[model samples]
Target: MTSVSSKKCNKEEYSFVYGDEAVSYEVVRKPAVEGLSHQKSQRKIAIKVHPSCEVVVIAPEDTEREDIHKAMMKRAKWIYDALKEFRGHLEHVQPKQYVSGEMQFYLGRRYVLKVVEDADALPSVKMTRGKLLVTLTRFNDGKTSMVRTLVSRWYKARAERIFHERLSELVPHATWVEGIPSFRVLPMTKQWGSCSAKGSLMLNPHLIKAPKECIDYVILHELCHIAEHNHSEKFWRLLTSVMPNWKEVKSRLDGLAELYLNE
Candidate 1:
């Protein structure tokens, strides 16, 4: 007969004061390697501060509680700075008013909204010259929701067409990846895009507002997940193989979030 013992894992949450702010974070312990002694296995802790300002700490199964605390304290300044910057960006985000001369973002460029009323013309939205030309059959007071809905539909249509085109252009470069995954454009509150274990990708419609390169970076990032699911070392190496300047592009996308996501 063979005897076996199972290892137990659990997650704990802790709060700490940083720069006069109470910051809470979660600590998780999970097995990282198999057939290795606990002392010999990788024990380094990993910390991530998400765009939504959520902090998570992942550590080896046998890591000490005090060590996690020490690590958090060491990185306190970096965490504080990131939170401050994110808050500053949030402060500037305001809902769209859909009025003429109001700024709208498209392909990393700013365009002024120009609402035109043409009873005979079809209700449509397009870029004429440099401005976003929104033509409607009639304009009345308290019709902002109608205008917003029409513009939203137009953006979604463009996102569907352009995202597919870009995916077709970039997928060939990833030789190791096989089969084109279906994608959908929708609004997401916390993430720009995500690839599910199933062969489908969900992209934020707001992404259509970003630069072409930034959009490419995001698509490639999700595609790489088909090859490597987790954000492990292998996943990043795969992403870099395709887009070496992904970090710079990612930064630009994050900065532009304030403009597009607020709407």
Candidate 2:
């Protein structure tokens, strides 16, 4: 195990501690906002990576050296890539894929796309059996930009349907949110789905590639956000009340990054 204490021990900054047996990392940092040093705990377990430019690991006090080395090696690639990519976020903000014959999602179901052109009619989407029929009666310039419009439109339709179904089943006790009005899908690289207190949700289409159980878990997770905005202890209690086996589902979902990581 490891222990961390803030002092000029070796004239170098020691901001982390790791437990060899615990398989977790703890980080130490001085409070950015002033004046709470002695009153509150300065060290905290770092379970997630910050969206910053450095690779920082925080471990519990009294952690072992061997475990700390293993943990660092386990997250070595993530640390390296995150630090490298943190500085180049501006260069990575390109539009989501709108390539022809790309698979899309509709209500957690897979859809093969079919795009058509019409000048007088606006873009519309319909699903039959296993196929997604997209009719865009507008421009056919053969440019990817023109197709992006229709693709974006299709995502909205799918997001709306899924959000409605999930809200109805998951939050039937509430009448405050009413119905989903403006939901959309995006190729979000950060999260699988997100919900707003304003009765809207943004989903990543890649969720369809996950297991059905994981999809349900994601839907239920977002639906619970309607009642609790932040992921507090109260939120977890509420989630557990609705989903007793959520831990198992979460374990499955955590490993699903490979499906969308390549995209």
Candidate 3:
């Protein structure tokens, strides 16, 4: 989820007005590769819109500026549509205020958060009477740092336990995996889970807010990476073999990601 755009020294920047919006984009020239033929070297211009709303154009070195502009203009509508979608996602994932009556999620279920001030009670968090209750011995209604801390800790603990349990159930189906690969629970802004080159996995704690099947989909996804590191055809094939309807599950997860990845 954390994507840091690389700074390119040799790049050209341009901006054009599209309706009421002024769109900015950069073009990075691509050098001809050694193995590529002359015709292949004249590659078509490639346009990419990043999650951070960065628009980048990759083009052959010999491509004229005017030609690049034409290509960009042709895709301007698509680019703007993509940008609007990501911007909406960013706006939706705002930080929580942790108010007593605020709603919270767990395992795809909603719970009303109730902060209770009990001078003699120890600080604790628990689900009681269908509510996520936070008991504070030294509660201050004005400051909610303690509430945030307690709720986050509880989420991390549950994520660690549930993620491991789901991984266990799905790993047996991933015939390529050796054993239960080590994994860590962490908070990520834009990723549900990832598999490292060393086969270790990182699952976002917020993902525990999703349903059990969704969690299994993410775990199975990383497990597929153990054998096929890159997202090549084989990688996707391996994933589909294990979870036949993975595409449907993935789309369902994508539809609910904005809600689940909340603070």
* lDDT scores in order: 0.82, 0.57, 0.83
Q: How does model 3 fare in lDDT?
A: 0.83
RMSD of each: 8.9, 9.6, 7.5
Those runs of model 3 whose alpha carbons end farther than 4 Å from true positions after fitting are 1-94
Q: Write the residue-wise lDDT of candidate 1 on 1-263 in tens digits.
A: 11122233554777678756788788778776778777655457888776677788888878887777888888888977877877766776788888787788788888889988899998889998889989888889846776788889988998998899999999998776676779999899878899999858999888998898988998999999888899999999999999999987887687668778766
Candidate that beats the other on TM-score, 1 or 3, i.e. the better one: 1
Q: Which model scores highest in lDDT? A: 3
Which ten contiguous residues of candidate 2 have the minimum total lDDT? 15-24
Ranking, lDDT, top scorer first: 3, 1, 2
| Model 1 vs truth, CA RMSD | 8.9
Please provide, for model 2 over 89-201, each residue's C-alpha lDDT reduced to its tens digit, 9 standing for 90 to 100.
Answer: 43443444555456655433556656666677766666766766666666456545656655555555555565557655665534334564355676777788898777577
By summed lDDT, the worst window of 10 consecutive residues in model 3 runs over 1-10
Collision count of model 3: 0
TM-score for model 1? Answer: 0.66
Give candidate 1's error at residue 31 in angstroms: 24
Residue 154, model 2, lDDT: 58
